[model samples]
Target chain A: MVSSPATARSFARQEGGAGLRDSVWGARELLVALVARNLRMRYQRSALGFLWVLLNPVLTTLIMVGVFRYVLHIPVDQYWGFLISGYFAWIFIVHSVTESAGTIREHSYMARTLAFPADVLVISTLMSRILEFVLEIILVASLLAVFRHGGVPAAFALLPLAVALLVGMALALAYPIAAASVFFKDVEFALPVGFTLLGYLSPVFYPLALVPEAWRDLYSLNPMVGLLGIFHAILYDGRVPPFSLFAISAVEVTILLVIGRQLFRWKRSLFAEIV
Target chain B: MSSDVPRIECVGVTKRFYHYEHRTTTLQEFVFRQLAGKPLHVRTPTFHLEGFDLTVRTGESVALVGANGSGKSTALRLIAGIYPPTTGSIVTRGRLVAVIELGTTFQPELTGIENVELYAAALGMRRREVQASLSSILDFAGVDEFAEVPLKYYSSGMRSRLAFSIALGSDPEILLLDEVLAVGDVSFRAKCYDRLAAYAANGGTMVVVSHDMDSLPMLCTRAVWLEGGRSRLDGSVDAVVQAYLQSVTSSS
Candidate 1:
């Protein structure tokens, strides 16, 4: 017989702002619940459920190490450390983009009934991947400890910021891609190929210093260029990334986020209808 | 904020749905469609809800009775704010909760209790708020035995009961339900009636879309007959229901 007062008050306000606050804060907790849900769903009913978190990167790293260190004969010092750190960050961007693209469309049922912000579907999917990323970071740390490259540089203290930048890069890409995927299913098809191409463009396997000086600035425009560059500086070299690198990355991320937010907000209204 | 003002108001609300051929939901389809140079058959955007209007005052229960595709659910959707009107405006007051499709928000892979948290969170309820009512919600759903198991294991009836329990816990002032009353077992239906009777007694306004004629007079004070998205009759339950029944029989 009783009625909740909060939503009524918000509706009575006659403006859009009041209700938005509920969603904004409400999504924060939902994010946690969803992340937890995804992790449980992923690992459910398997004896080696938790082990897969550790095992996935281990298996992937073994293949990459065989291909890059032995087959390609790339001459990078501490290639083991480089491969995992770079690989973990790259996987975050790649998985976030691919998964976020389908998040809204896949969860269309919720869009038809529930009133939570649609973008959180994209955001929470990214958060779940980020949680996986955090687990994989443990792998990176162990590898770094085992490799002891240059005694694990002092700049490694900035690992947290490096992770943030990687996540930022994912968010920027996920926003636009998630919205576009709803209207054009081709987005989902193109994303994995796009990420593969993006891998060669970014310094996933090789070092950025190796790319010629003339191409470096143009390459730095990739956003991930600066993001991964900082990641390499901290985790690989144990030195803080140059402020100039951070500056350009900061600009790129800002512009990317602005464009992403604009596109997502513009197209979000049509989603319930078209989806 | 005046006592006389209607809690929910729809003014000339018309919603159009584009009828896409081949859907063209992919870039490949779109490109192919463009290369085809605009097929001879051009589909015009059609209005599902054309010039529809309704006003439900506070403390009133209205049942929307219509045949399939008669815009019963569409009207409920518009009031729930799931879809915006293509033209005109809809102004709503008071807290509202709509249950259009049961289990739409459940994540089947999660445990029953976890799904409760997830569903409540998606419905815009804060965590501590759900936490305070957590046990009570579980009790009401009567699925506490399967709470720790993944929801995929639960039967459809259990899922619907879970969804209804979460919606009921919200205690919304305005409840927009679309064919949701026949949610659970016979015992649950009786329980729903007892609770709904109490809810109506507390001055809650509700708009329900149901074809269950026998339950009309017992559940609602007013009945709105919508034909093709337009309000055909809006009057006391018995009068409008009788008119609608006559129209159906004569047309058939």
Candidate 2:
């Protein structure tokens, strides 16, 4: 029932703009099925199942808190709250981008054989990661509540905006990266190194105050800095992020999305041939 | 809704594939090529199909008969919207379901029933439609007993059977089949033919690519014989299949 009665339609190429939106809207069922399959496959064989979603961030945060708090002796108070908030946001971006970059190649056979929108693969990968990240955010909020007698911050109401911005940024990057990775094997090899460098460059582990004032403008150009700053401001500092941070992040996401969508649309039809 | 209206049309359709030789697959290689004043990627274009045209009306069954690499499958894929034609236009009316390489979209780790839902969705079927047809699909594939088992455990025959059943259950207005009848055992294939015949008789538009000369006439009323991507002959199934068979024997 999704499609109406026969109407003359051309299938020469995938459409763009509103036509592309309609195609995606028509394909929403496929998107849901793909996301469901992705979630199931992620933990199907693991004995711990969904626990792995929580365990990954918890375990990684514990190690970082141990190192920064005890061994490295960083001066930030309530380092667990600071680290957990920023780390969860950072990991979400990292996992979504890294996994999405290779999703088209992983499902190349399906892309070639099936006629569904190829971008659905990238979107579904991000959706599954987003679902996992939502669960991880709950865990972070609980830990923050326990550590601080103030309970969860009221500013946390703005957390959805932060998550939305993070996802928008991730998708903007993922579309182009996923499309390019199909042709260039280098993307697969280069992503981890790029993320590693980005991790050090962003304010994921340490406080932004430690960053020298002069270098902050250049650092903020990374996009993740603004996004992580938003998370940190709301979750750890219990306040709204500066309007400038939201503005910068929004502008960057818009530009990246436009470029990413154009590049992805141009390259997708070629995928069935190449991949 | 008119029976005379064309369900599928191809106008001067041409498909070309580039054979990449020493393609630049890395940034370093691209940079080196730029420094050396060489093209970023080198490839030779080969035409798979050229200036091909066909039209299938509603309730019509057509057979694309050709040897391997003659563009029958490529044409089917182009019509199915899998690949954009390199230099032409393809228009289709009605919901289309293509069984090109069955089970290729199925995940290995997912159970049989799960894959059915996934595959149905891939074919553009909604969740409710898939759920409604789920039992019949499983029963037709004869994999109902193992519906909960992962597809990785299914035999090759079982996988194709399940895939074919799902495609048929989708109630497609236009169905494209590329040598799908070659799968499964004898009885199952007979069942597949029966299902396809029933579909064709029920006013479903079908363009099938098959080499089984005997069965092509049984299912299709007309045949288009392709040679090197161009239609060499187009006529009633009996005449075209006979001529094609004669060419094959005489050439051999």
Q: TM-scores for chain B, in order?
A: 0.93, 0.96
Model 1 over residues B94-185: C-alpha lDDT tens digits? 66778889987887678888899988776656788889988888888899888898899999999999999998887677888899998889
**Residue pairs whose backbone atoms clash in candidate 2:** none
Per-prediction DockQ comes to 0.36, 0.47
Best by TM-score: 2
Q: Give the TM-score of candidate 1.
A: 0.91
Best by lDDT: 2
List model 2 lDDT by residue over B5-115, tens digit each.
788889878877768886888866877889999998778877789889999998999999989999999999998888877666777878888899988888889999999
Scanning candidate 1 chain B in windows of ten residues, the lowest lDDT window is B38-47
What TM value does chain A in model 1 reach?
0.87
